[model samples]
Target: MLDNLPLLLNGFSLAVSPYNIMLMMVGVFLGILVGVLPGLGAPNGVTLLMPLTFGMNPVSAIILLTSMYWGALYGGSTTSILFNIPGEPSSVATTFDGHPMAKAGRATEALTTAFVASGFGALFGVVVVTILSSWATRFALRFSPVEYFSVFMLAFGSFVAFGGGSPIKALVSLGLGFSWASIGMDTVSGSMRLTYGFNELSRGINLLVVVIGLYGIAELCQTMQASPGTVQPVATRLSPREVLRAVLAMPRYWIALLRSACIGVWMGITPGGPTAATFMSYGVGRRFSKAGARFGTGEPQGLVSSETADQAAGSAAMLPMLALGLPSSATAAVLLGGLMIWGLTPGPALFAERPDFVWGLIASMYVSNAVCVIMALTTVPLFAAVLRAPFNITGPLIVIVCLVGAWTVGSNRTDIAMVLAFGAVGYFMSRLDYPVAPLVLAMVLGDRTEDAFRQSMILAKGSIWIFWSNPLAGTIITVALLCFALPGFTALWRLARRQFLPPPVASGR
Candidate 1:
């Protein structure tokens, strides 16, 4: 680590140059906009801007793109907090506690905690990239189909067990999501499964459309039904004292912050990416925190866990893309393409040939994290002001934004209609006390999980024991099984004890 100081300094010098700094700032601002608004996400934002980087130096182009990535991660929380809508799939975890905090008139606190935690997580990811790139890349490559499948199962099992709802209901929601995900053409055989003879259905439902309809339009419908007349505003201003206090409180949750960062980094290096990291961290944090029982009900710990992991994974994803020529997430894949377009080869070879480029990208991440935090904090008043407006006025704006977001994907009108349908489904699910998180999460992981399981089975020549053939895969599978079984075991134990225990004496009566 000590031997890399001069290279680090050179990287920092390049990142801090006037042109690069300005580019970083612009990227952050646009990224935040894209993140807060519906439809456009980090991948879309980066791809839209990729053409503009054609004539620029690779270092400058990457700094701008990566900064935008960080900014979008930060910006996603804004909409999740202010409204029930999550601008990105990862931000869905943020909505578990963030919007409730907003409704409780603690929007300022929620936003502050999310932004600060995101900065810490992103900075940690960047530092880890600089110091452990080689080792981490190698470690990530060790995850095979069985291990990946076990991990995905663990994620689903965790939600079913500790999602603070009826386990049966969670399972039902999970199954529903999987069913919805199966609507597209089959990847293995190229045969359509549930398209129902419609050409649009053959293409399958887009997750972004589902998210926008379920959260945005469905939320508006609920608001309209709940408060038929005048819509009131919540408090949105934060005092300087409050700001300092929130900043000071950061140390109290350092353990959660650090744990979330680690989880994020792991997911970022592997195939799970930021969305999975946020959900997994949030679920684990809920089970571990003493305030676990209050998760999804305006708990600050949930916000911290979700936002921290979300940003951390976003940053860590760059490591595998740059060091291994592997894209860990959708956004990273777009960046990977950009890297190729610039006549630069990714992987270990890039490091040997262009040390300055690699290190410069690493150093610039540090600067971007700082810049994003500052920009988000300073703009708190502006976002909070949106919460000040009456729901009637802001409601339509959100709907319009949701429509715009839906229109951006393939310019398909069918998607807009699907959004409305899912909005209705979401509203009914809420009314029925079903956990939407599981549904959304399962939808996100369904295709990947199925593919992994099938691939594992094929590799094992149809043997079911392949999941347990390797020690690593076996251990993870065992843990995942235990997570699901613990609840049932406890219930049975209580029933047996009740049956064996003697009746109470008359004195008890």
Candidate 2:
């Protein structure tokens, strides 16, 4: 550990450089600007900026992009608190108490509390990243193709079993993602399988294009088609002294903050993203809050718990990206692009060869997070001004961003078309009790799943029993498969049993 000091310091130096600092500030500013808007979200904003990085230095490029991601995290809370609209899915949790608090005439307090919560949560995330990165590196090194395959299978299984919906619909989404994943030039046979006749099809579907289009562009289209909701401004003020007092109001909340952060970190360490963390934390917060009844009506605990978890998840999401070359979110997906542009490959080689890149990025997270807090405090008035923008004007701007974000991925016009097409699909999915996260997760992990299974097969030399022959591989596969299949099996048994059973008597009767 002592021998690693020099490299750690080098990373700090690079991350703290004037140019990188400026990039962080710029990213945070842009992130907030978009986040505070009505329809724009973090992923769309991050995706739109990726194309411009093609000509920049990788480190600077990364600093800027990551800063934006952090900024959006901060930014989303503003809308949730002020207008009851979550610019990002993660911020939906924030709306329960944040918007209600505003409606109850504690606008300034809720906003400030949210800001502090985001920073505090982010702080916990940085500490986790700083302390656990090395351990993560060690663990990631043990992941062979079999391990990765099992991991993806386990993750997808968890989603399917837990995702509340028709099993057929969920499976359809998963299979579609796998099919779309197969469209690229075959990684093994070098044969084109699904490209139809287009030359771009041979180069295959770009993950960024698919994700950004599906998540962002589609979301915006749905928003545009729907009736705009009520979004009135709240006028309130809280002094520094008052804000500090507000933060200290619930000493117990600090415990909640820590708890939420842990939940977020755990989710990110797995394949889950901030949305997963947000929902999980929200559930825990609901169960634990002393004033639980006031949560969706107006309570600071609801806001604090949700925001804290989201930041923690976002922060921890970086671990797998840095340690194992796995990206758990769309922002991480963009960061993956930045890593490639920087001429760095993520894997065991990274830990051995580029400790500075790893440490510098990790250390920079501390600086950038602190910077976010201070900047937000000083710039509260500025963010508040975002409320001044009329919805009529902001709506078009968000749409423009969505379109551009959709087009930026691969410069493919088909991707642009898919954005609107998928937007309707996404909106309807939302209406039908289907989940988008599982679909996106499937799309992201599909290729990796194929690669792992293929490699494991090749290693086994066409022997079907090879997976079972290795004890470790066998156990992981068995667990993953069981995790995936058990819920449906249980559901089927319940359905069959229900056929012979009579309905229960009414409670009153």
Quick one: best lDDT, which candidate?
A: 1
> What would you estimate as the lDDT of candidate 1?
0.79
lDDT of 2 by residue, 334-371 (tens): 57655765688877678778776777777778778877
Instruction: For residues 1-509, write the lDDT of model 1, one tens digit per residue.
Output: 56566778889998899999999899998788767655456765675566667678999999998888888888788878876767677899999999898899887788889999999899888887877865644554677778778877876776666665677788898898888888888888799999888999998877667766666677567667875544333465677677678788888989889999999998876646788899999989999988778989998889999999998898888886776555655567667767876899776667768878888999899998899998877776675454445666766866777777677655899988888898899888867878676666566567767988999999999998999998988988888788778678878898897779864653554
TM-score for each predicted model, relative to the true structure:
0.65, 0.89
Model 2, position 5: C-alpha lDDT score: 60
What is the clash tally of candidate 1? 0
Candidate models: Cα lDDT each: 0.79, 0.75
What residue runs in model 2 are displaced by over 4 Å at the alpha carbon? 1-7, 164-167, 236-238, 250-252, 289-294, 378-381, 406-433, 468-472, 496-501, 505-509
Model 2: how far residue 443 lies from native, Å: 3.5
